[model samples]
Target: MSQTVDDPEGRLVSMIMEANKYARFAAVCDKDGNILWNSHRNNVDNILTLDETKQSLRRAAETWKVRDTLAEKIGRGQYAIVGYEKIKRITVPLQNGHMLFVSIEGEKPEYIKDIMKIVDYVERNH
Candidate 1:
């Protein structure tokens, strides 16, 4: 018998896909605010590139309309509600301490938190 293992990208897609199961959209970013990946409901992991993802992340990061304490925390790598609509953004530090800013479903912070932990764990162990 033979088995297969998911590569980093594969695992990343899987992790993101799982996150999208609850979040309207999920994405991972780097320390300097570059988007590593993004997934819609289908979780196909296609139709985008690293550069494109980074652009989206940058746009999302600069999209601050609220003057609350949480908005300030974003520049300093903190997790809180950011979007105005039903979307919530959570910026988290990954295993290597890189930041992953995610703007997902407002009612699904837990989904991002759960996948965030997994992303941290996988990268750390690898």
Candidate 2:
């Protein structure tokens, strides 16, 4: 599969998607909200669109900003989680101003732990 310049090897996107079975959507984006690689499960009703990806990236950037500011005031942030009526978004900051984002249906606590494990694995390997 072809990957963007930011994700030449597509490792980040692969990592996100492989993190858990419940992951409805996953993507890696730069700090400026530019998508590097995006993936979603087939046969899903809520397909991720270009505009939605852009919006997701923008929200992730904003969340990062808040995380950084809060970290400065308190301590380093571990991760950020945003819950919606239908899906929950989990974001982890990666190296080189890149971020890994995953959206899952409903609220599953175990999914968060699984995704975090993948995040740690990516950080260690990549």
Candidate 3:
């Protein structure tokens, strides 16, 4: 009951991979909240958890709908939105039109900062 879109390119992939290593848990989803890619997932659990799925979707929708969400920020050429979650600190608004959901075990502002760097790097290249 879902669909997937194409993936992000350039430094985004490398940046996500880097974040996974440091964060220990991370996920990337499309604007519609479909799973496009994930790291440390043994059996694609994020798609299975209904709560998480909804939360992911909310993040996406807010980004696209709200005024200050990551999607809006990226759309307006502002800073990338870094979401601080209980089990994760994530970088959002992947690429120009996609969404990224990262879940790390511990709090690492540095990791989130790194993710922002990736966004900045990608935007510059694009």
Candidate 4:
């Protein structure tokens, strides 16, 4: 008999989803915002098209550039947290220039804590 296990990527997404009730979307993408894995197809939220994903990635890249510049002048940046009118985008830089992007509905203080936990989990596990 053979046992089959969920892949690491799937498991990571599951962990993220389970960890945050308001998590609208979670994804792992390159610096260019090319999504390697996403939770949207799992019925997370509004399905993101390829173009939308690309555009989001581009915007994230720009945001990261600004963050890096600011960090250089002041201190190291822990993470990037961008708040939109409806949702909040939390990004954590991973190894190899990849990023873990997680979006949660609404702007809440808990989002920061959730992101920190998620980032720590990813850093330790992935």
Best prediction by lDDT: 2
Judge candidate 2 against the unseen true structure and give its global Cα lDDT, from 0 to 1: 0.72
lDDT against the true structure, per candidate, is 0.53, 0.72, 0.53, 0.69
Residue 47, candidate 4: Cα error in Å is 7.5
| Best candidate according to TM-score | 2
Q: Rate residue 111 of model 2 by lDDT.
A: 77
Tens-digit lDDT track of model 3 for 1-126 = 112323344235546665445454445566666655655534333423657665765665466546445434455533344445545545466544566655555465566667767667766766
User: Model 1's lDDT to the true fold?
Assistant: 0.53
How would you encode candidate 2's per-residue C-alpha lDDT over 1-126 as one tens digit per residue? 223344332665666565566778777788877877777766667745679778978887877877788776788666778888888888878766677777788876467777777677667775
Residue-wise C-alpha lDDT for candidate 4, range 1-126, written one tens digit per residue = 112226545455566766677887777776777777666524545745768867997788667767777776797566777788888888877655667788778876476776677667766776
Model 4 alpha-carbon drift over 4 Å, by segment: 1-10, 41-50, 69-73
Question: lDDT by residue for model 1 over 45-119, one digit each (tens)?
Answer: 433465775775665444422322354564544344556455666655444544455556556656755765766
Better of 1 and 2 by TM-score: 2
Model 2 misplacement above 4 A = 1-9
Comparison by lDDT, 2 against 3, better one: 2
